[model samples]
Target: VGAALAAAPGADEAYGGFVYIMWGEKANCLSQVAHRNLETLLSAAPNARYRFFLYGPAQAAGYRIADGLSKVQFQRYAKRGYDVHMRLVNARWGPYAPATGVRDAWADQTNVGEDWPGEDRPGEAWWYAHRSRFPYEDKKHSKLKSVQPHPRDAFFNAVVHMYLTGGVHTDLTVAFSGLEKLTTGAEAQYAMYGDGCERRDAAYDDIITEFDGWDVSLPMALYFPDAGHPALKCVLDKYDQAVQNLSGLDAMERYCLTPQAPNGFPFYHEEEPHEGDYEAPPPAGMAQLRPGHGACARYLLETCKAQTELQDPAAPALKAMTVEWMGCDAGFHWDQWRFPYAASKPFRELAAPEGFDAAGVTGVWTGAALHGKRWEEPPEEHFISKEIYRAHPATRWDHPALKAGLLARQWQRENAIADVEDADRVFAEDPDFPKCAAALPACTSFFHDFSELKDMQYYREDAPKSPRNAAAARCSPTLIIPGAEKGASTFLYSLLAEHPQMISPLKGAGFKETGAYLAGFDRPGQLWDKTSHFPLIRENEPFLTGDATVINMVDKGAAKRVVRDNPNPKVIFSLRNPTDRLWSAYRFTFNVYYKTHLPDLSYANIVNDSVDGFGQCMQRQLSGAAAAAAGAAGEDAGDAEIE
Candidate 1:
């Protein structure tokens, strides 16, 4: 805490300050410590702006306390000089994903006092009995007290229920921790991620659900499902999209074929295409073509009908077509475009006089822009690359055209090479990431699921587990993560275990803490070897391995034995305020020991008297043999605080 204060202010221009916290034993306790740490730091440090994102009851505690105390007291925190720009309460606890019928009692946030003033218990209680009938539940859960249409009206109601309403709205900076929930496999892929019409538009939706988290470093990662920054906007365009129409293409990319694979062509048209007119016997050109993708696109182009011709564009005939999102083709170049079949023009007059069977059979050499009064001439130069013309068996090419064709082909090869470089970079940096990216409930499409599977395979092939790690376990003494009681050893353990580079007791040994030093294993090496308990190697890199047992610092003999066995071993120690640690230990121990092991001890007596010899060697106090003699003679030599 002192160190961070001593250091000059850090910088994140977007969101000013970080609200750091550690979840503890009791949800209440965890929030308590986290709140204290956050409040202490913000009060001391000076910063340009602060964006406070709080979670659970601790956040509401302020609002609850303020409402319980007085409105003026609550306003005081916001009145401070610093810019507390945003206060978003992500008020979720218990399972991140729950069944449709289920409801969390704590999550049912309401302030009945606001409606039935001074009634305190009775009037509000009466309102609560019939509140479900009125629209009061709507304002109770909505930010700014407004209703937004939602899909699955029941789910919309569920979202409304998660709102935090206990606190009085502070300043403009205050925001509701809106509900946006979607686990990986819980719902249909498109339902939770499509354009605005899908109601799964993450860009517009609040509350995102991710179980294992993702490798955000991947290019265009956020644009995909389950991996994106909170600030990222999803669902660029809104329409009742026919998602199932492209299922086959989606499957191909997801499973055996990768999205980036050259063989699996993307749906969107490229910047340029080879041109060949259907004049004479037949024009021939070797160029890849990706025409209208879905049924709607094909129908519109085939019918030569304008956007107005379709009374309802989402008709079955048009819904299955593939097309671009939206664009402007004012320059006569095909570059200006729009998609979803509904948006693009499909008139025969816009293309050719003999539209359907024209050059290349149903090709549109020209088209009208959405706003333009008249049709524009085909921008032949833009669409027809010299490379396409050259590819034809019979061609009278100009020197300039031939040179340009060759240059374009060379550029393509260079781009392909650059793509390889990027793939390699991703592999080298996060090669083994896929092994753990297995989302709970599992992703549906092979393209999305197999994306990580392929990466995992590549990592395993490139970096096999080391045999030496098995050997290291036989002789190497375990690294220790000792604790100052209540210093978040469990929280730290879980975080470290998530890292590929670190191995904890759960990974190496069977249990989280072996307790071998205190237990006095006959042959610790043999037992460890027999169990094959070792930190497994990953990616040809050694892991930082250790076990956590908070008692080690006070266990003098345990430390001595570890030094004797392994001359050099790392030790991690975490500390907290003595009084705070005692309080936390009280909470933990009182629950476990009060009725069972320490029936004789009161909470206060335990906290005050037990602090002295809790982690000390009582024998050392009397300086060895003389004390040993006193102990042997039938005297009460051990410290009363010790036992």
Candidate 2:
């Protein structure tokens, strides 16, 4: 402590001034040392003045001395023009000290009693004596006066009153809903006091305070009884009454009702008068309503007709059919303007009703836009050269006698050659065609030159008995494509559709049933029976066998049928990384499902609930089903089986 004091920036200065003495254990021992030190300094340096300040435990020193030696010393310092001050450290001393006549020495030096009246006294005396009364109390006439509202509380009440009368209903509701009961008596008086509307408002404020901690959803439901909750109905009734009363009365009377607006008044309304001689018509080109048009034309027409019937009892038939046709035309044009894919021709042709001029435009030429830019009329020029044409002997001038007869023949040969050359160029440029050609094996001899030529006659007689022929007969097989929601199942299904034999069922059929059945499979025979009526492909077996029939059942059409039968069947079980899956699950649960049932539940609540064990339960169910399926597959099966 001494080191800290010595290290203090201004502690070394000789100009003596008032010193504050902190109280407590340290102060009790330090005060004496401080006083003695000050005296020694005074003896050494006569010009330096000294003062004593006793606070906390040090203040108790003066009182502890029955003869009051410390008190006498303090007075002596004061007499010698050295300041002496003492202060009480205990916060609770105020109330008891006044009644006991045990004045705090610090209080006397600061004139706190004169400044704040009885505030410096103990809580028992100061607070109990001036506490607010519930009914009313007269300050001047009554011996025991009630406490007045604290300034902060009075200001808050005034603001609340302004908001209520000013027609800020939402603000009033929010303010009242948040207020909690005050713990201290002084705080309570300051929070609820005074006469007129402010006092009346206090009554309602107390009721709100009582219910502040209740669940908001319960009251919300009651306030909206159509929602079928009694509590909500009661709250709504009170709210409605408050609004209605406020709306019917004058501002001053409304204020008197509850220091807030009376019932039936809306929070805010249009300020301008509607009933005036200078009423203006709507602005030019503004329609009374949006015209029935665009993709929603049919829907809009029906809606308009229904609205007309509601507004006018004597309304004629709306002619919705005729208007709808016109609306369809408008929709056609609208779609063409926005998205030209609907039209047979390109969008550029539609946009340019007049002839298109590609040269005038800055971009590269397109076939649709080059109609007028490339030629004023058809060129009619032949693509073939005369020299090339003459090369054909049938049409050469040297064979003039047969020229007329061979002219057609010559033209056909030239055209055929051009077509072959064009085809060859296209094949070379195409990436996939070359790759396919390279993958297929080349045959050196035709069927007539085969080593089994001697058995050809028998083969022809028994062609139906061949395995290849039977497989080809079973080509029109059903396909089953099971998939999880938003997974690659759809994409795979689309790709598989290109195969003529594969047939997929329409979407919306349950795909998960296949997975569920597969998970329960105890043997291959069970799987075969489950898919028996469907189509499948057999390995190295004839199509007529039972195995082949079972394999055929798993084709595209059967998959579709399975999905149709089971809406929630598990098809493919796919999962993302844990963090990503959790995020997706959270979004699906809260944004999709929870919004429908519990809209007011916060994100924090959802996350906390998930972390508290619900999420683990869901994950376990999914994994458990997968594990069961794997166990049923057999001991030799790999952990990551796809089919």
Candidate 3:
């Protein structure tokens, strides 16, 4: 963690901009004393940097249940308008824990007032463990009951994600979870593992494993009795006997579970030592599981006048901090029960002033989640997803211009200047307006991270000496390698990106294929801000910059937008025989989707869809200079027609 911060440009200097956000799933924050020790260094180095993106939105993001603040408090927080960065989401289900949160499972942090979510912490993930092996008399595990991907709820999460962003994710994250593995006694810690317990054979006698997703570095720790023990193996075999699908999960659990203790008692769950500073172990009653009920609600309230001055000066900068009774996935988190649906309720139905009507929220996919439908091709179904660009040509903007778009709108709105020609005019013309001798250089970008830059203040003429916002007229990408899907675009780009000089999005393919030129126009600055997007490098030092948005290859207007935004853009297109490319892409695309969301979709359906114009998605743009003339003609035509 310290290494990452040290690598940030100028982080070692008198005015470092690195902001470390200490967070985890539950309220496992350090004690006031520990928090203060870290706070002292940050407080003393005021210019070095100071900030923390509070983990307050865990409930709001459907990642947890409501543990902090009441419905009123939550609604008020949403109304207060906190910033949310949306990006490519490839969500899968499973119960896993963040590393920092490991200690939280032993004890909790939020113990302020009477209103706090009690010891169980129904909204946090750690407290959800009780729901795994045991259920209350009334309710049971939802994911275990459904046994299917909650794509629809995910769509709502995605839509909420879009609503939070100005309609597009800053970048994309194609991370897939579901990576789980079983381990024997060879793993890292034994029973005496940091849980404040004395060295004991109990920890070493069990089989402990991990279930993690996305970042392999982070995984959920799952502890079980030693599977090799004969007595324990007998109970596991019982579960193995009851499970019907012998070859599937049944076999998996059969080999994995300990089922019970060696002494023939039911499986026992242990909490870490909870004594002061964890020097002592938890007492009998304190460590045992208890059942209880919880209720929480959220309503997206229109941000009143609380928006930051620099966000969208026109429309209130959208911010929602809230979720519903969406099923809680297995590995067990009582706190996460029905998180998706429960927390998302507020985003769908925004709160209103007293006596006024509330905004009835609609899923981004509308009834798509409830309805049996999947986007097969073109006219992209999701707004931020491709089709919205085809529906409206003027919606696009390159990254640099996208950043400027917000400032342009702000300038235009404040000046009341309706003239199109003056759209680029700077509005801070007053003699008393603050000014700097020279414009600061843009921070070309070091990695996908949030720097000290806050809001549009970094876009002014007298921007900081070393750019706070990267002054991003020229998005860091110095090269472009649009592709013909089946062609070796992946192979070609990978080889190029490996060079020390080349820099790409950490989310590689996700950021590359984003047809932003078609959606970036009029997009908010957050769309390009560190909060929304990530850079691939470390420190501002750069040798080459570029991206490989293969989709841009098919969307002719996309290439045009890129060139128009930065005339010197280095562009390359990987070519191959149409037949070979299509054939390869068809098989590859079918297999990928099948493994992902389309288990029910057959190879025949994939072939049929490809034949019926779905393949149009693979074409590498319309050729010729006419297409490259750019959006000028099309945008003008729309403007003329409108006038």
Candidate 4:
């Protein structure tokens, strides 16, 4: 399958590429789940590229990269010699399909053959090879082309996005990590497809009964080794067919035995006006589509068949894994712990798929598991219900095995267990056993469970009152004075410090400047020690600390750093008459500091030589200001000199 997908020998370049898609403004509660899941994945695959395909405004969705992953986590990863990089892409631009405002090609073509052209039939191999155009016509199904809409329409854009920007397209809820081997596909197909449902075990017969009638065959997560895979195109084609109700056409004409196969003939066909002459159907595998509903599954099967000849070398043969959370499979409804479906099942049951190598199951795409509650889901969809616990008294959160699994999962997350090897150990080991189980009785929801498992000893160790961290917590500047150098910033800082409510950094032999922000603390190993700069204040004191770094105003990064680090810092910028400030600066630098070097030239001589240059600079500054004002008022400042 790897050879069939056309992957180069020993090049696992695509293994680290991951794709995450969100269509519209997702709620914060739901977005947090995605954030947590992404962070979890990064813990395991620290160097992987997490590409977010956001269809709508990311800010509106509260999906900022910094907001999702904490600064401390980034620092931790960076310290480990790994850069956790996430690439956010605007999914609306370029060759990508729009989520809205496209012609509803599926609207009027409810009856398959009536509107579909004979050449557009999906079964015909010619269309796959030649592909003149997408099957749908541009003509409006209704008078208004955009009138009718489907829930799956925007999701279809997700399919298009996966094709355009290939990688592993994952649902936000799915978490688990470490699937380098299967992903690189050193032994098997480049593409992999798996079920969203848990692996079927006879032991789970009673517990999994809630979803007995629900169709769980459709894969929640999809993997394609490369972008523009022909199989994905086939998936898109089938999706178009599904939207138009044309996907069932081949099955519709199966009994009729049409000589032309599914060559877009009408569903009902007769040889000679009721004289029943039997014709052979298409071959067995081609006769019945594998997924029945899932376009990807069907098309991948088709693409594999088409690749029997060497002409299409890129045709993907899918490696179908058993329906289990083999690490990479999504835990579909796992977080609906209150629901009957999840409450009865233990996490360990899903953690280790029976008979499989513990290491082989690398990642698990927990499909909408965290956020797929009724309220979060579409109105038409119902994933899990909170009332299930109320309805089923037998299914309780404190069930020993279920509680144990939940506790283990929590421990894995709390400890930042990056490797599956360590994660699996939680099932057998009870690092926080007594404490974790003691808190289980109080657990009301999935998020609240295993609260005690979190080692708060770290928090205790760095208590704000502790000598080392006291000033760090208290002295983080509430005020910053990034000065206009040579501006009377020092005098202003002195005056502010004199106020009973205000405090400046402990004045020493040096200037009242920390110079911390000037030297950027953006990257790892760059430390900003507030303690070294400011004196620790008493617990009862009502005082605000400040860093009056004079050069900070001119430092390009200082102001930005100040804003980023502080919550509501009051910035004081001291301004002075430009000419006067320049002269003061000149006197300070040339006469005071570098006076010995220029022994031959007196201050008067230096001033006399620099007057003309200073005058020109001042004139240019004034002229540029005038020009800017004039431009704002729609007037031209002719021959204005810009500084």
Cα TM-score per model = 0.24, 0.16, 0.28, 0.34
Superposition TM-score, candidate 3 onto the true structure: 0.28
Expressed as tens digits, the lDDT of each residue in 1-643 for candidate 3 is 1111122121122433222222221121111122222222232222332222222222212222112111111111111121111111111111112222222321122221114333522112312322232221122222222111121112122222222211111000100011011111122111100122122222212212111011110111121211122212222223233232334322222222212212211111222222222121122211121111110000001111122223435532223211111122111122112122222322113222244211121011111111101101112333212211221111112133222332343342354212333333433453321122112122243222334434444322122321222223224455778777778877787687555444444222333443445544323342333211223221222234466767777775766655543456667789999878866876786666646766555666666766766456433233222344445466555445333
Better of 1 and 2 by lDDT: 1
Model 3 weakest lDDT span, ten residues long: 292-301
Order by TM-score, highest first: 4, 3, 1, 2
Write one digit per residue (lDDT tens) for candidate 4, span 1-643. Answer: 1111122222234446644434222221232234444444444444455544322222212112211221111221222233332222222221322222221311211111123344533322322322222112223111221211121232344455555556555544444344444456532232223333233334333433322111122334556565555655555565444334443434422222122322211111111221244333333333232221232333333453464324566555545543234343223333232232443333323333345332344444333422322112212221111111111111112223433443444453364212234334554575666465434222111011123323323222122222222222333566777888889888887787655445445422122576757764433223213333443332222345678788887778877766655645778789999889977887787765365666546656677778888899888888778777777664454334332
Q: Over the full model, what C-alpha lDDT does candidate 3 score relative to the true structure?
A: 0.27
RMSD of each: 25.1, 40.8, 23.9, 22.3
lDDT of 2: 0.25
**Please, what's the RMSD in Å of model 2?**
40.8
Backbone atom clashes (below 3 Å) for every candidate: 22, 48, 35, 10
**What is the C-alpha lDDT profile of model 1 across 1-643, one tens digit per residue?**
1221122222112322222111111111111112222232333233423332222222222122110111111111233233433221222221121222212322232221224334222212222322232221212432211111111111111212111111111111101111011111121111011112111122311111210011100000000122211111001000101121223322211111111122111111111111232111111110001111111111212232223235444422211111112122211122122221333353222332222221131011222222111111123342211211111111111233222222233233333211122333433576453332321111111011112222232111111111222233233334567676588776776676554334443222223454645534323223322222222221211233456666766776777655554456667777777778777887776876755667556677775566566535555654564556557663454333334
Q: State the C-alpha lDDT per candidate.
A: 0.27, 0.25, 0.27, 0.39
lDDT string, candidate 2, 98-169, tens digits: 322245433333322222333322122322322221112123212222112221112222222211111010
